[model samples]
Target: MAARDPGASVPVRAAVARQAVEWLVELQSGEAGDATRAAVQQWRAAHPEHERAWQHIAAVNARWRGAAVPSPLAHAVLLDTPAVPARPLPRRAAAKTVAALLCAGGGAWLAHQATPWREWRADARTGTGQRRTIVLADGSQVSLNSGSAVDVRFSAGERRLRLVSGDILVSTARDRAARPFIVATAEGELRPLGTRFAVRQHAGSSRVDVFEGAVAIRPRDAGQAPPRVLQAGQQARFSAAAVADTRPADGDSVAWADGMLVASGMRLADFLAELGRHRHGRLGCDAAVADLRVSGSYPLADTGRILDTLRATLPVEIHFITRYWVSVRPARR
Candidate 1:
């Protein structure tokens, strides 16, 4: 099998590493289905890198086995007991303990890889803590917020984008072909009229904020009412049934494209929730401090640094249960 180039992009290398770890964990689980076995076989056959990665994992496992302890009691002790009372483990038992550690590590990696894997493979996407801009074939520009994904399709009559998840800011160019520019989300469709706008998709609704010109929002099932036209500085949210009342758009709405999260007297919980969109895993605050007001502009690129700034500026303490699990609480005097 040919080895993968060491200089491959970080995301590609990380994805392959996760796949290798997942395969190792599944095979060790002893309950891998026939389908799982077939999938792994297909994966190895599809790419030489897959076989190379599997070989590396196998070599690591062999090394662990060679240094393992002999006694089962020693394995249990090493796994469950504290290190202060160090005890020499038989070689066979130590091997089993190493294998168990490897399995646990693989399980943890799988948990971390679950959420953003789809976005990682999207046609156009931004990873957690990443923001990017893409220029379409027709000269239109789309800026993706962190953890966002969008699929673009240009046909003879229309320029369409499907918002699979997260948020995007679109600046429509004058289409020489005169194809209408449209963005579709689960909730509805947004048609831009020579406009610059932002669209965000939530669990049950989609929001459109027009920065310039106008956008026509049509609910997915507009039974009675006609499409709503939102002019510059207006924003509205809609579900499948109806469009909400238009509200004044805030400058903060498009600040994310500039890598800044701008907040003005926003609740601590709401601010954290928005910030979490650019991050991975769970990031919340204790209910006790949920109502506290926050006002600032923070860089979205480094969430850890943003958290550090919050801890320094606010009367809150940051608690990290794990790198993936974090919370903020009222600081103790």
Candidate 2:
């Protein structure tokens, strides 16, 4: 290793930067296992820039530590090591860092919460508060949700999409070339059976809701286990190991495509969390009012109005701490 110049930062591709951030997120999640740590080591060794990006964070965090920053929040965020903090930063913290990286010299697009850093490098993407419908070379339609991304790869033999992050509703178009339409995610693979369906990805799992036809789901690590087939109106959530039992698909799953957030007695915290995905920065709920139930078909385009409606109906106050940070709490007496 050579002593790097302080003035010249290494040019890091968005792809490599994303991998670094992903490792950081898992490390900060406080739930990383031994396998995860080993995987992180292998990833760092896989490329020189991988190590550079990683050391960049570690060095920055080290500088923060040496500065003796007294704030607990600062320490929690700056401690990027395997040593877990008393209160680890949420996954959103990693998301925020990746968002910044996307904006840093890459001409990449920053995404909303719940999106993986890899989305920055995706072939097609939708940003915070944005949705798009993409027609594939095979004529298939992919309707991206807020903060979604996908990469398309088509050849004479196959038509495939790699889901980088977030969620999408796919409407398959018959291919003149007789190519199979497949979608790959970090957790597994999906082969649609002439269908319309929605796919959503999170940290360790993937979910699919089938609307018109059937879909076959094979977990990434389920080497010998049979892939589950989901029929119309069915849904399932699966991880690398196995698939959960299929259930009737919730009609509201696709409501976002219609610019609606349909909540049926959802917790106030959960509702705001979903709504937060459409907005930038932090949206939190104090524990005192977190479990309050909410039901509505609110227009997603008007989250501000939705908050006003909540303020009117529920016994809660909307605190606008800043333009970027909002919280729901028990109304002061």
Candidate 3:
């Protein structure tokens, strides 16, 4: 059985649990061949927690062996329906219903866990409060910011870096092979024309900031628009359908590569949100102080000290719910 850690985040636990449930479902479906079974054994052995989650899920399945539960009831539970039964279900029947609920809920959870699983399998990643630089085989350097993941693929024709999640600062090195360098996000692909630049992946869009030379932003959908070129000191955001207008880039866009967050008149809420990206757990600002402005070059390595500085200089107070959870509110007069 996998040893459970009390400190693991909900997302991490859910991801593991989902993987376990997926393995169980595949094996039980009677289609998993000998190789599939062997792979499952290897996976379970790879992590004790995987075995533990599987055992627990198996126990849940065992409870429904002899009882029948309505599919609608199971589906309702998976959807988090608020409707309640007028009369309580019988004990044996209730156990069967609960087991069905667990199976359906697990399937839904797996769908939500897909992205995190990809990040887990990323070729390169950085943890919270940590930054990493990987020198590619071609001598180009890619720096990953905290909580970032990227997959590097260098083929004979082109050098591609997939921004799986988070942000990266790329310094292009002249390739002796003369392969074109490109960075891809869900929204589009960025082709650097001998440039130093940064690419950040947001929820539904990707941002490109060019520090030197130029980059061509091409939307993933070919008919959306033509590729737009951004020169040095320019930044732009693009979605699958369209590219936004170019704006003047700022030092803060690439400052994380230097282990600092350079904010000039940034909103308190925005600052805290960016800081939270580098720190573990949750850090938020109350609406009362969210609009306040902040400016400075704060070290990303010391989030606590940065928060302390904010409290000292601004009209805001920091509240610690736990070491992992914090909020900033209007300072008490």
What would the TM-scores of all predictions be? Answer: 0.65, 0.69, 0.69
- Report clashes for each candidate as comma-separated counts: 13, 0, 3
Off by over 4 Å in 3: 1-108
Cα lDDT tens digits for candidate 1, 233-324? 99999999899999997769779899899999999999998898777545768999999998999988788998998899899999875555
Q: For model 3, how does the per-residue alpha-carbon lDDT over 135-234 read when each residue is reduced to its tens digit?
A: 9998899999987889999999999999988899999999998999989999989999999999999878999989999999999995756699999999
Best by lDDT: 2
Clashes of 2: 0
Error of 1 at 19 (Å): 15
How far is 222's C-alpha from truth in model 2 (Å)?
Answer: 1.2
Q: Least lDDT summed over 10 consecutive residues: which range in candidate 2?
A: 105-114
Cα error, residue 310 of model 3, in Å, equals 0.9
Whichever of 1 and 2 has more TM-score, that candidate is: 2
Model 1 residue 145 CA deviation in Å: 0.6
lDDT of 2 by residue, 225-263 (tens): 888999999999999999998889987968999999999
Off by over 4 Å in 1: 1-121
Error of 3 at 170 (Å): 0.3
Query: lDDT at 50 for candidate 3?
Result: 66
